[model samples]
Target: MHRLVLLAVDVALIVMSTLLAIVLCGPQSPLPAIANIGLYPLITIGVAIPVLWIFGLNRTVWRFTSLNDCWLVLAAAVWIVVFSIAGNFAFDGVQGIPGSLPVMQGLLILCMLVGVRAAMRLRHSVRRRGRMARALFRDERENVLLVGLNPIADLFLRCAAENAREHIHIAGILSNAERHHGRSLRSCKILGPPEAAEEVLHELSVHGIRIDRIVLAMPHAHLSRSAQEALAEIERTGAIRVDQLSAQYGLSELMFDSAARVRVAGSEPSVIAASPLSSGELPASSYLRWKRLIDATTAGIGIVCLVPLMLIIGAIVLLDVGYPLIFWQQRPGALGRPIRVLKFRTMRRARDRSGRNLTDAERVSKVGKLLRRLRLDELPQVYNVLLGHMSLVGPRPLLPVDQPSFSAARLRLRPGLTGWAQINGGRHLSAEDKAALDLWYIRNASFALDMLILLNTAKTVLFGERIDHRAIEEAWRDLRS
Candidate 1:
């Protein structure tokens, strides 16, 4: 899966480089002359993919690509140029295209291939730096999962808990030894064997508990394959970071008292603070990470799938309302940050070229009203989802004036296109009532519940909204409790 995605990205980069080489090599106004540059581009790509693959370009991980790999990249560029020209010669004797176009294209492809890898390496470096930096100043406690249970683990847990400055809560422990199952160390339960890491994570996610990071209790070289796989899976999901507790760490200074004192002078941090669900710094756990990945991927695919429908809607709006095909407004997003929400323009200008103002009914076109009824206007906000402004299911983003008083909690999660409130009572629910239901989602969020809300959304759209007074009351009761 990873290699396939890399191959696709390379192909796209090669195609883009081809176009750029043509434009830069050709005379100005390259559009009119593109017809002359015909089959050569197609022939070039046919030769390039196999040649690049043969050079083993796709085998290297972009994030870890180094100077040692540059020779291979350079060799791939040379072969692409050679075979492309040969393919063109075989196809049509290489007559019409510019003589230097292939060379230019090859060089451009080489630069882009290397440039993208460099960018990936930089992003990886930046994220690591950001985490190290955040740990220094963040007042919120981190939820930690221990990957092994041993004497080393025992000492680390004891020191962390007893240290006055340790702002960490030990969620549980995972041991490779079956003997440690159902055991307890320093009031921390051995959740299960290391192989059940994913299962343990999912169980925590249901109750809004997310492990910020996993610490290997023993040496890296001594860990078992199952322990390694568990860590890799967790890291790959981007859910939690994994670190090893070195002998030097315990010898030099514990993560708590001494380090904390050195990092911040004369300040105290909460020792073993409660779950982050209350701190507003929600852990990027299994569900939150999967939700983001799903939201972005689904929205991106949805935009591609709905492009034709969107174009049709745009045409209707243009024909009826004229210009400015999209309507955008600022709405309060996650944590009250402002974000621009986009939709197809469903209304005409308030007033025409005339001096008189128009009525609200006059502003809305019949086509617009129909779009509202069908909820097609919400389609454009999928791009918002792709952009990280919203999710597929959550609380709706409200205008500043319309937001509920308890919006701070609602905003903990990003506003969604369709939410629990939308599928439940929708517009009929009072502001406070909607807020209560949204709060319920914040506390007990899980992938299963999100899927349920999405399934019900279809029913709500087809057969108007349903009101559940009991559910609303239950939400309020949970919140108060």
Candidate 2:
């Protein structure tokens, strides 16, 4: 039902925006071209509907949708207009059609795509402010049957409690394995496991209860092929939807694999599980699709816009540090994986007695110091953002040695170039302090918070507020003691 709602909303918005764009900006000397033509809007919309879906815009949930998603649609619109115009110019030699048509077309596309979305967001914001904040129940609370009672399951349960406002009620827990049958979980009684799935579903459905969704709390590390297949078969019954909640958020396997809730051979194959707590949560596909679209668009534009500045910086770094101006290091990435981190080297070469190395401050060259002061050293990480290895905002990645202890916390998220810590305390923070900020970010990360952080980062960097290094030293010393 939620999926259907999203689809309807997306289609309506897309069509309306397309029509508005044409009416407002379509090529015409005195009157709008779109108002005169009856079929052009329809044709453009028809063509754009598939493009939007292919770009995964409609696939996004309206609630958790971000500006990045809007940016993606905008980029796709630009591509559509640019390519069409270029083809017209190249093949048709641009003699017949007015140049204003392409310009108006591009403008109309951008305005409609962005403006309608903005209006929808305003409506959502107003609704949220007026509402008492609760998820709408369908007849009754969602009848959820959880398969495991492990720590990950517990976390999911906690998520359920937090989002109970969303109306998910645990029907009970089940464990087909003999070892788990007798165990108790809080208020939930442990029924039998996989073998007893049918009997349990029967009893629940008979008593005015509907098993809306089945939850698998099996951690990725402990999942087996047969168990997975069994769950798949159960979901295939169409009687209920199946979801998996696992602790493999940072597992390298996912890097090479698709999301947990992917369709395989026309079936909604279990890929990644929805957060047991995220009832009506935005799908992962929404984020992946929008993030890629935004990253590509932003990076392309940023590179073009910042070309002169980047060149100037490159020349400075080369002259000041000699050759190999860019500093690239392997850093732990999303899901505890590895990716190359790029920055303008902010340090000079300085070796210790063993010829091994020196600390950050000691190695930092004079030019590097100036770069660090301006935070210009980090501009290169925009490429990491472009490559999808990082986000413009997220938990900052850690060096491998710096990551293992906080693996669980960091694994819960994708690493970012600038994050809560960067905006809050940045270089002035101790490891523990940084962790606290990261955890805080993990706890309250939202589109609004990210925007606030981005704004603060700009302020802090442009103002050149030197970090309270003294405070960081004191915090580090206290932690050591």
Clashing pairs in 1: none
Superposed Cα deviation of residue 81, candidate 1 (Å): 20
Give the local distance difference test score of model 2: 0.63
User: All candidates' TM-scores?
Assistant: 0.47, 0.39
- lDDT agreement with native, every candidate: 0.77, 0.63
Please tell me which predicted candidate would have the highest lDDT against the true structure: 1
Point out the worst 10-residue segment of candidate 2 by lDDT: 269-278
lDDT of 1 by residue, 1-481 (tens): 8777777788888888888888888875778545677677787678667656645678897777889777778767766776677667767786667877877898899999999999998897777656545664674668999877666687779877644223677889998778878889888989998778889989988978889988887666666788678679889976698888865475433332322321212322121122234345554557986889999878856865776698788888899888888788999898778999988888888887876799988899899988887788778898789768899988899888787544556788999988887877988988767877877777777889889998888888788878988888787677666
Off by over 4 Å in 2: 1-292, 350-363, 464-481
Model 2, C-alpha of 8: deviation from truth (Å): 51
Total residue pair clashes for candidate 1: 0
